[model samples]
Target: MSIRHITLAALATLAAAQSASAYELDYSIDLLVPAAWPTSVVLLNVNPSDWASSTRRGAIEDAADAFLLNPSWFFIEPLEDDDSSIGPNNENELTFTSNSALLCGSSACTHLWYSGTDIVEADIYIKNDTYSVGNTKSDNLAYAGSYRSLQTLILHELGHMAGLMDEDGNYSVMGQDWNVLHAGSTDVSPYLDADSGAGLRELYGTRVGFADLSVSHWGYGGSSGGFSTHERNIVEDTSGVEPWHTTIGGEPYYVLGAGEIYRFEATLENKSDTAYTVDVSIVISPDPIITGADTELVRIPGIALSPGPTEVWLPALVPEGTTGLYYIGAIIDAGGDVPEWDETNNGQYLVAAFSW
Candidate 1:
């Protein structure tokens, strides 16, 4: 099934507007109607013309690699070319053609259609006249931004071809460019963000062996003032993890001695629109344990979660003699309690080193 279909004429109009400010605008995405692919493997052909050029070709390769890294069951492979051009063909094609008239003054554009109202194919047109880096003035601050914008554009277009909609916010390349709105904000990698990865998994299924939830921002919560229970309560109330503290995966990790009680916190955000009721299972596996399959020291049942961030806090004891890298993780919606838009992003991990 196809999520969306547009003719070349309409695509040109959209491209004209989109190219105007690859720098500005909060991009929104939609899964075209009748979403989901009929087949598991989709082959694509790249235009020799686009591949002939270094700059344009690099963008194409980067975009392709992003998807290749996480296919979610649907494999998109790029095929070699011959004398034939992108046209009415059985194979999907990505082309860089010079057609200012068709582009409506935009640097590049894409058009897609299903082969039989079920299977899909697409054509990507990059306008040679307008999208040249050599022509862009380096000193023009506003215009100078177009260099990265071009790469972002290529990444964004390839996302559409792969059956994803535009997403808003600073979260993903599928979303708006965060760097433009926030000065000094690091540029978004052309790589797939959490949302994009979740969406792809939802569409095609997990990539053979990958988790549904990815976790980060871990740390231990403890009472600040003294050893007494009342003092511990006071400390817990006053102290919190700082932004600069070292984390296993951008989350906090704690080193506690034997018999110590620690309160832990972490963040979980849903990638899809669908809500799920999950068990937020927390585990402190011994040093050297890495995957979720490792034993769980504890499980917190029936935590309700949806397509956004949820902060989890629970108390646990640091066992005697526990030391080295212990894997602390929170598995949301554990055991498939509720169906999710993407099931692959359900388990997250952090490394906490324990002491006697």
Candidate 2:
């Protein structure tokens, strides 16, 4: 017998301070803990014919690859096409369907069948007719005037299969805001943020002697609320709605002046078990990608971070003679003092900006 588990859809809730990490899990009533896969690896079957566009198929594969990064023992291996249907078929499948009822009023959905705390079977469905799906913002916007990111949607559904609950109102792949356009930008990337990684570690185990630190967008008030790059200059609409803004390379950008100092709060997360002392640096770059080689604005060293999320307030200065658009971001463990499971995710760009 198969038992229906979880479903994903558009569910919204007020933003609240997370007691631990921003990630939540699917609980088992009998075990009183998170339901998870018994084995270290889970096999998934996908038909190439189901996706006519190679780019879309690649995007789906890329979403699966993101979870293999670090601090995640739960791995996925894609198999050849299988004929098993979605519900209680005893086969793990990933496919696209035109049926609106399968989507549950969302672009996609993941259904799982579990026995006690062990997830036995899972199926993922992506709506083909309701929305245009694309790999990039340009392709998406050009194709349908607006589009749904196939990669981002797949990543969120995969997170559900990994035993993670929907984290609405925060900067996470499993968040309710995991659409193509979010917070005035089309930045739904096919990458697992630190919060999602932490949740995976909680169910599985963590990588020893290594930590994954990251920074994400921080906001105040309820769902769909306003957020600011500069803390002192908080921008909010009269009805408490988030203001619309333009983006560069799918990331939201801000406007600032040279030689000005700005303060911003960032959500720093540690996706590991142990605590570590590391340095956090604020930097500026010409694009959305952030690196240690970027122009340094300030560095705060020796900050202790326990496992989970911590609110960090940082101050940055726009250098003189700086003009045009640049990314303002933070790099945790900038000096590489501490070892990490995934060094690529250590740096995160919150706002790309234009300086006058």
Predicted structure with the largest TM-score when compared to the true one: 2
After superposition, the stretches of candidate 2 with alpha carbons farther than 4 Å from their true spots are 1-21, 51-53, 82-86, 129-145, 177-188, 217-255, 320-325, 354-356
lDDT of 2 by residue, 14-83 (tens): 1234433367788754546789999889988775566455766676677778667647678877665655
Give per-model TM-scores.
0.46, 0.75
TM-score of 1: 0.46
lDDT of all predictions, in order shown? 0.46, 0.63
Going through the candidates in the order shown, the clash numbers are 18, 0
For 1-356, candidate 1 gives per-residue lDDT tens digits of 01111121111111010111111111222234335456777766777766677766666665676556452666566655665566666667777656775454555555666644353666666665434222222311222334444454566666666666555322345554211111111222333444555566666676644433433331112222311010001101113332122433222345555555454555454444455555555566654223467565555555554433344554444566676656555566656655544454455444345463
